[model samples]
Target: MHAGRDASDTLAALLADWQRARTPYRADAHDELAAVLVLAGSNADVERLNLAARAIRRQAGELTGPDRLYRLPGGRTLALAVGDHVRIRTNDYRARKSKGARADVLNGYRGTVVAIEADRSVIVQWRRPGADGPALATEKVSAVYIAVGGLSHGTAMTVAAAQGLTADRMLVYGMGLDPHTPYAAMTRDRLSAHLYLPRNVLESDADRARHSAPRNGAEELHRALNAYAAILQGDRADQLISPEPEPIAAVRARQREAAEQAEVQKMAQAVFAAAMLETVTDPRRPHGLLGDDQLQERISAAAAQTTALAKVVEVEQRRERQQAEQVTAVRAQVHAELAGERDRLATALTALDDAAHRHDAAQDRLRTAQRKVTALEATLHERYGGRIRGWLPSGERARLTEQLQQAKEKLTCAARRAEAAGRAEQAALRQAVEVFPAAPSAAELHQRLRVLANPRTFASALEKESAARVEAVLPGLADQRRVRAARMASPGLGDSAADRQHRARQALAALTAEADYRHRLDATRQRGEERARRDPAAPALARSRHEQAQQQAETRRRAREQQRGYRPSTPPGITAEGPRQGYGR
Candidate 1:
């Protein structure tokens, strides 16, 4: 079996065996059709090998009959010669084209091309499907059907297609795809299965030649062999999920259970479900279970159904019209409210703007007054340069002091004006908030309107909707009736007409509560959708004048620093706090 040896080892052994036998691949060597099979991994290799086989036979003058070229599955052309192997690729021949021939030339059936007809249709001696026996039927396949990509050159079949083939010797190439593929390929021979794989192993590594250079051929082969082996044998499955080996008795018991389940299924389908089992109470009824048809009654039923459908369509149209009218009214109200609020907000904002202007003007005047006081202080200091505080003129000091007090008074008046303007701005802002308010979010709006498209079961067609409700409610009623029947256990005492009416009323009450709850949920969602509003205006006035106050204070501090650089500056009490604190406060 070539056990414990790889394809390369087998190939080397094959070469040694061939040399020992001294048999060559000459045209005369296979005169009696040598008992050998050539297999490949791909269609391209198969096509090439098949053509070589055909040419060898032709050179030997064995196949003298004319041949016809036909297309193979993978866009390759194959010439079918007498005594050449061919495999049927489809079951279409059995589908209406041929009768007795159809049954024989099934898919995967290997055959020999016996004759080529004038119309290019070929007569093939076909083997029975899945059989290893010799060809049992000779069928004339249509040229039109043969033109289909269904006929392939089978002289050199792929390892995938060599499953049904068995010969004295088999030579397989380029089929190291998986362990199963090579295993299946190698095991198809009665005598020897020779596999040929490259020794370098780099040849097996697809696209590796472009990107990779092996540091050491031996090392690369060693590494690449492991990966190649993995590709050949995916997911090593040596260990069982149970971790314990199943006993023979347990295995038999599990198989027995499976068999028993199969038998039970067979009984369920085959034995229990006969036509006799489908008997109805009345044998006179048409189709037994299906009740007898009444001519006038059936026609009336159809007419009534059509009228109901017409009513439902009318109801849907009226509902759409009413919803449109309601939406139009609500949208008009929303626009009107939006316009009124926007106008009020604009008026209030304009007032706030005016107040802000007045506040800014008052601040400017206070700053000017403070600057004048600083100038007077600077002039006094310059006029009396290098003078001691006691030597300075009392008249000039009194004059500077009076001017500082006057400036402080003016600042106080400006501060009062600013404070009044701030009050006015605040009043305007409050009025704006009261008039415009914030826009209506879904949560805040008083949503009394609902715009819902309920399901057909609970919508405008009340009568039709009731049919569905009854259908739903009856099952529950039946369950209750069944429970009562079980409790009573009498001859139909629990299922009387009055009792049925009572039970139906209880079901109706429950349905009414549930329907009401659903309506409330739908209404809530619909109202939320209906409560849309436009964005509101939020214009803010520049109310706080503290930034200007800080600037003025900094300006005054710089002025005092300049005055100090010259001579005795004015008194700190009058320059720093007298006018500044009056307005800054």
Candidate 2:
């Protein structure tokens, strides 16, 4: 199915099916789950097949990169680039690892060239256990001598080279071929396979003598195909039963030994077998057979067998019954124990999943905390290199800065409220002294504030009121914020100074994040549009340096928290020196 093989009579139908099957193949073949195999018989045939495949692949636009090529073992020059798959042909722990992390880039290990650092060395990534970090392990393998013998071509390989390899689909070229080697080559595909053989007609004398000469073209093809099929069916590596032809003397010796063994067994069991046969035989069934008394006498004489055989049978049957009971008991015990074990295992798996989730969350928090600590330490070092030099440690400076911002906000809110209150008090005092209209109601105040907040929408009406002096009822309009927040707990004026400072910091951070998000959104839009226009290649395999799925999960978790109105508390403390005790620091 992967090769789009279907029952078709016409060439067009066959080609159409192949087109669909080969829809999403890459020029580099990196996007393919498995490499296309062009199996051939000889080295020259292999080269020819490779040439044909290369010609067809290049029509799809070859991937361009720095002209760096490595000659593999067998004169195959493979060009290494990002996204090309490779398998380790040799065990190479002697080579230096990338980023000081050792990976088992041993023989038969498969990986993709995530990065080509140099002509001799490339960074290969091994798959991780989960979807979260698919490509987790990397190793930098380089040539110790001439070519990097560890790195080899993975897209196409010879039968000897493909010993332990597996693939998705295979194309077999069985011309001038023996089926012996192809046994290993053909079964490598897990999905689909095909065999293309050059028809071998019985034109030569030896072949014509062995096989029939066809009378017609169809008959010729039929004979050739039948011969090829017989060749394939007959030369199976496993079914080949060729021990060296036995020497005549050795064969005679074996035959004599087998005859002697048979004679010994026959002699050993002769008496008992004869007695048993005689005891079971009845000769009185036919009219001319022996009479009842004679038959009884003969039977009695035969039945004069020892009781030892009866004892042996009884003992064996008893032992078998006992063994059967024991087996039944054991089976019941095993079933009971297995049920309990399965329950325990299920419980353990559930607990393991929960533990894994908790571990992941803790790791994320640890990373966030570490980043914050690093930033704080950097600021501290920048401010105060030593104890005697600077006035504040990083934590102390941040605390003071936060306090200052809160203080300024509180001052502004208080001033606005005091001004508004003073104006109100003065108006009240003037009202007591002189005749004045009743004070405006709370609803009236709210309406006025709402108008002031969006003056454009009610601009003409408010302006007309102002022109007519109708706005002079109350002293000055309170701030457009809610009446309680405006007069009492405004931006930085909260239940406590610390609370207000935290709110201010949260607001500032939110604003900063929003601005950054807006910039990134625009960039993301442009990138997405451009990417949509780009040709589909190895995007499925060559994801970003880090997995986007992990980031997406983190984003989703944060979004859920935001939807629930969950706010994070300040992270724990760190200083330029190191982390300090939260109890005392």
Candidate 3:
């Protein structure tokens, strides 16, 4: 059993020395603490080192909570808890070693915490394996209590303070000095007074006796210091010291400024209201509120203006009405004048109508007279050698007088012939009377002759008849022959039997002569009339008339040909007549 304990102790020391050498002070302590804690055996010392290592690792931002695992350089791992043994480098002892010193003071060395310090230092019992014993046996052993200062000490102190540990002075091995004072504890006054000591004096056997006389007393003192440091560290951690009171003061000042602004706004609103009231009370503008006097004055002015405008409108309207009336009056006057003119025109028209009727009557009478004169002239011309001019001008009247003289002579010759016929009739009547001087009524005379003559005696008596009777009978008989002869001479009657027998031979010849004479007379009269209407001396106009006559003659010839059933033969080499043929032929 003693051998086993010695082997365990030697192993713990070697592991601690390896940790310190690998991670010196000013280097990260977390790795060093972790290595030592894992190497420590399952003893009270190992348990305490593990806890202290955890705190140091946490402060160095390595090991965190109880659930976190620590990894060693050789791949060994362990969970951290409270009260685990650990090894850490001493910051004060690093300056004492020579540059080339080959001593392995850190190698194979380990420490134990007797008590925790407020400054994150540990009261450690260090041991290394001795050459004369088993590996677990503690060959070299020492006890030192240490505190850290400056950046290195500050980091460790910050963690120890959080864990309720306090320390002002510390003993460190392998540091240039055995005991190091925390910068927080040393003042400028002490340094200026040269209140300094060597590591031997400060951490000597005599000083250790003075400082460590009562071990429990030192422990109690550390506990008291830890309580105070815990309070201070808590205040720093929560940032509670200066921020709380200053926040309240800032809130109060902000509230005051807001109130002052509200007061200023209230004054501005009052000023605005006052200005609005002033505007409302003004009177020069029509929209503003008016005082009583101003209102009355405006009303009076408006009334006067309205009256003046109404008068002007009325005057303009009256002028327009007057103009319209004038136009109507002018139109009426013009219409009246036109009506008067129309009446005068009607009277004149009536007068003209009467005069026209009278003129027409006179014209009708003149036409009647002229027609009578024309009839007389025609009668005179026919009976008097075609020249009678009683109604003609003087020169024409002279020619007509000659014609009248010739007509008168013809009348005288007709009278002489009529007288000769009268004489012949009278002579015959007288001879009859003379021969029948004793003539009974003619019937009685005829009866006497019938009685006197007998058949045998009549032949003898016919010779002896009275001369008076023969004269009377012979004259009457002769007158009867003349009448018969005169009847034969009339054109309307046929010749007597003797004459008819003789005239039958001459009838056609006489009819031909008569027709020829009548035709010649009609032709001569037409020519005379045409010559009087159209003078042959006017050859230009005459040629036109001749052509017109030729056209008429041609029309008559064609009519005659049609009546005679005549048709012209087609000309040689002509198939049908064209328009050219109508003109040329």
> Worst 10-residue stretch by lDDT in candidate 3?
170-179
Runs of candidate 3 with Cα error greater than 4 angstroms are: 1-302, 319-323, 336-375, 378-585
**Per-prediction tally of clashes:** 0, 0, 28
On residues 218-318, what C-alpha lDDT tens digit does candidate 2 reach at each position? 65556555656677676423345556555865676567545644543333233222222222221211111233345455444434322334455567568
lDDT of 3 by residue, 313-416 (tens): 56756864764465455545544543443354344334434444555555555555555555555655664443444344565555655655655555555455
How many angstroms is residue 542 displaced in model 1 relative to the true structure, after the best TM-score fit? 99
C-alpha lDDT of all candidate models, in order: 0.52, 0.47, 0.37
- Candidate 1 C-alpha lDDT tens digits along 342-405: 4665576667677768877877887887787778767767765464764756787777768877
The runs of at least 3 residues in candidate 2 whose Cα sits more than 4 Å from the true structure, single-residue gaps closed, are 1-20, 25-31, 35-52, 71-85, 94-100, 110-115, 118-120, 125-137, 143-148, 160-167, 175-184, 188-190, 200-224, 230-585
Clashes of 3: 28
- The positional error of residue 141 in candidate 1, measured at the CA in angstroms, is 1.4
TM-score of each: 0.30, 0.30, 0.18
Best by lDDT: 1
Better of 2 and 3 by lDDT: 2
Worst 10-residue lDDT window for candidate 2 reads 1-10
